[model samples]
Target: LNIAALLHDVGKIGVYDSSLRKTTRLSNEEILQLKEHPTIGAGIIKRIDFFHDIAPIVRSHHERFDGHGYPDGLANDAIPIESRIICVADAYDAITSKRTYNKPLSPLKAVEEIERNSGTQFDPEVVSALRNALEPNDLPTVQLNEDDFEEFEIPNECDPDYL
Candidate 1:
């Protein structure tokens, strides 16, 4: 599960830098390309035999509980627990992190957004886990003014020395 979570966005490496760094809404074509990251990420993981078990989790993490997600429209319990958990975690981070396009939301506001989307964009069970996890401080809390984008890279077969 940790492996899947860490590498879930590895496919974003294939995306154009301009696209990833864009400060505005994406165009239709750009959105389609961006949505392919999960599939690309899963494929990359599958090539490593040891990571085979995590491939599906990475692939399905974007699936919505309402069966309206991309790549596969899996609904409710059809999605794996690992994927569902990752989805909630990913959503929380995305909501609370400052990105090129938007300011970060307050933690409280982000939680409300998650609550509002329960059973539609996220699994309720997973959201519950998030709420519980937050209450116990399982997740790290950073000062609002802190810069969170520390640079890091995953070395792959073609770039073993990159990192």
Candidate 2:
């Protein structure tokens, strides 16, 4: 289950469009196709068989805390904790990552956004774990521009939003 959430995005390897990985805004149609990566990941995992439990976690990674999420609008505890954990983890990864639409914010900044949306886009408890995971060692110096090198850094203390 843990590994599934960690690697659920592996199917993204198949997307040919660099735009799929761009940090810029996506059009509605592009967003639609982009969302399919979860289902595509499920498909890929299904053929592999051993990862059956991961398929749904992959499929529901974007589901909302208030039943407003995609593929399915499952609300409340209808979502598995395993899935919810990934939802928070995946979001944290993207915000901290250098994508085409945005540069990585400070970890404090990312947690601020997550804490701001906790009861809405994210689970409050899961949000805590998200912030907790930032132990001076997890920040990735990922190449956002795909050219500029990353300066590896992590912050101490939780953003007030988490408090």
Please report, in order, the local distance difference test score of every candidate based on alpha carbons: 0.86, 0.75
Misplaced by over 4 Å in model 2 are 13-18, 133-163
| Candidate 1 C-alpha lDDT tens digits along 116-136 | 999999999889878876773
Q: Relative to the unseen true structure, what is the C-alpha lDDT of residue 161 in candidate 2, on a scale of 0 to 100? A: 50
Q: Model 1, stretches more than 4 Å misplaced?
A: 136-143, 146-163
C-alpha TM-scores of all predictions: 0.83, 0.75
Q: Each candidate: RMSD to true structure? A: 4.8, 10.8
Per-candidate total of colliding backbone pairs: 0, 6
Candidate 2, residues 1-163, lDDT tens digits: the string is: 6788767787676665864766567777777777777778877877766777678777777789999987678876887787788888788778877667767776667777888989887888999877777754665433345456667756545867545
- Number of the top TM-score candidate: 1
